[model samples]
Target: MNLSDRQSKLLFGGLVVGLTAVGVYLTVAAPDDEPERSKPRSVVTTGPTAPVAPPPGIATPVSPDSFDVYRLLPFSQQEFATAADLAQRFTAAYGTFRFDEEPRAYADRLAGMVTEQLGGELQRSAAAPGLQEERRAQQIVATGTATLDRVRDIENNSIIFLVTGKQQVTKAGKRSDDSKQYAVTVARDGGSLKVYAFEPADAGQEGDTG
Candidate 1:
């Protein structure tokens, strides 16, 4: 409709105020966007989600087996085996003797396996005139065999074995077996194993020939 400028301006201003009131009322009355429907509330999980039932009559292991006590010892497995072998050989050498072998050679075979002090004793015992003469007259030829009975004791760097030394003697075409038990000590000697000391099982006094 044709109207004056002042009337038109008044009408435009009233329209603007009415629209602003309506916008504010609509904004306050409208609810939120339904909180996005909570997205069905999915959760992620991993690894052994449930307690697994073991098989019937099977026991659950308390824990994995640990290391052996022997592994904690100071010596290596090879060293221990070497020491044991040395002990057995030493006992065998102690009783084995050839009829034609010299006293020095016989003693040397055993002396080399023993400590210096023990070796000296063995050398003296082997070189005895009377013992050598008797052996020669009897024509004795002995072959020795050894077996370990038990471990008598253990030290930091040594082990004592209860050994039975068996000797098969042939004299004048007659054969006989002789067995004796001794406590044999094997110890470390300058990066090698040697017979430290040995005695009869009863620890009795030994003759000069021991």
Candidate 2:
């Protein structure tokens, strides 16, 4: 939470990038007579899914990958899926680490997966004494999983996903679980997806505490 001025600006910028894309997609892609939510909450959830009414433009329910909006976006269907997957993968890596590794060593796990700016912020956070001290004392070794809860935002070349990261921490033979929601932004890096920003949801990806 103690982010530097530069890191704060990076995260805030990512938060705003999606609104324009959302507006563009909604205006240009919809030919339906009625307007309905394009991406329902169930589009990505952690629990059982019930049948959802298809959006106004689509006559029938479609699988996530088969959604019609992908064709309307600057990015392709494959790229969207790949971006979502990268967001989840980044969340998992962010939560997983060993007690013995130095803080920088922990940050290295995220290399190549994040932008240079966000990567630096993560490294700095990982090195926070309060966060690392307890882990080292407890000899914690964490393994985690990330569930994409929903798409928070999108642009021509980026997607921000709301993800829940659950980590099982094993400390001195005892295991416990913890989870947190994050606004995870993945943007196009050359030809591949890379995480451009990550922050706890409470930080308000929308500028609150950015």
Candidate 3:
């Protein structure tokens, strides 16, 4: 069920309704939830040069071999920092789910980072009793490590992060772990970059530990 990059893009038009959890132990995820969104933070880079957004009508170039969309294109430093910061915040918020916390509370925490469609998905899947029951019975807890694997511009105002991370699931006294890669898509909403889709790279594929 691994979705190719083309298929992933199709989801932008509301083509997909549910997404697999990838390596996450919780499979029940996808419900509608909304929380107040915070304003996007301003980007400040080193040096006295003030960064400004690119003007309209200019096409941002793409790199076929790398994720550095701004590498050859003329882009302000602020854009780089903004994309990086957004990716960091989304990863932090996404990887912090706890079994002991209430699902609604968790959804609230992520409301600002995700789009409404994604929020609903999160609430539904997180609130599932089956997932809760399994976690409770196994004393399972999960943690994730997100790394910026690559970055590329999607549309003029959006960026996609090729993120690599490790998900560690501890059940009872034993732990099982796997490393996974995901493409987290973000688009500019007002002044903030909001996540619209969270899809794993090579979806439906599993990693092997050596």
Candidate 4:
């Protein structure tokens, strides 16, 4: 049987509405294209930093016991050793004069050594009449104590020492003594040690040079 024109038009309208509803439902149920929201990102930072280092050309400090003025001469150990040997020789010469019976001979020998080691000024000073009398009476004894006080590398090579004690003297069967503090400066002279200066600090006239 053939349908009427109005009924056929109504059927076509209903089919179009059903298709629209099915398209909407499929769009809502489809899976998403983007990744999962719970996953962590994979990013990297810059490379590790380098370590710090000390500067160059810095010198380490020296010990105090290693300081010696004579050692400073020529700035070498060999030169200082030579100066030390010479200092010992001078000590021997002065010691002989200090304990000799013939004071004049002792004075002559000491004057020669002083002139050679210290110069003409010291020689003249040793020859003074008053000084000669003191020598004859054995009023002084040239003695020293060598010690290494401190060694510092910050300031040019430097050393500190203390020479303290007394000199014994005998006059007319009576003995007397004197106490003095002496600081001796040392330097190297042509592979030998020479005393540059003797600074007297605390000097007290007690009695003798013994």
Best by TM-score: 1
What TM-score goes with each of the models? 0.63, 0.62, 0.57, 0.40
Output the worst ten-in-a-row residue range by lDDT, candidate 4. Answer: 151-160
lDDT of each: 0.84, 0.86, 0.72, 0.50
Worst 10 residues of 1 by lDDT: 61-70
Superposed Cα deviation of residue 70, candidate 3 (Å): 4.6
Query: Where does candidate 3 stray beyond 4 Å?
Result: 1-75, 204-210
lDDT for residue 128 in candidate 3, whole number 0-100: 96
Candidate 3 lDDT tens digits, 108-195 = 9889888888999998888899988887788777776778877745567677888776778788879888677778887777766688
Cα lDDT tens digits, model 1, 1-210, are 898999999999999999999999889866653466755787888776676767888677233486455677766778777877888899999999977789889878887789988888888888888988888888989999999888888778898888899999998779999999988998988888889998887676556455
Per-residue lDDT tens digits for candidate 2, residues 1-210, read 699999999988887888778988899866773556664555555877787888789887656976687577877878888888898999999989988889888778898799988989989988998978988898999998999999887787788899999999999889999999999988988767899988897683476663
1 against 2, candidate with superior lDDT: 2
Q: Highest lDDT among the candidates is held by which one? A: 2
Model 2 scores what on Cα lDDT? Answer: 0.86
Candidate 1 matches the true fold with a TM-score of 0.63
Candidate with more favorable, higher TM-score: 1 or 3 = 1
> Cα lDDT for residue 68, model 1?
55
Candidate ranking under lDDT, highest first, comes to 2, 1, 3, 4
Positional deviation of residue 198's Cα in model 3 after best superposition, in angstroms: 0.6
Better model by TM-score: candidate 2 vs candidate 4: 2
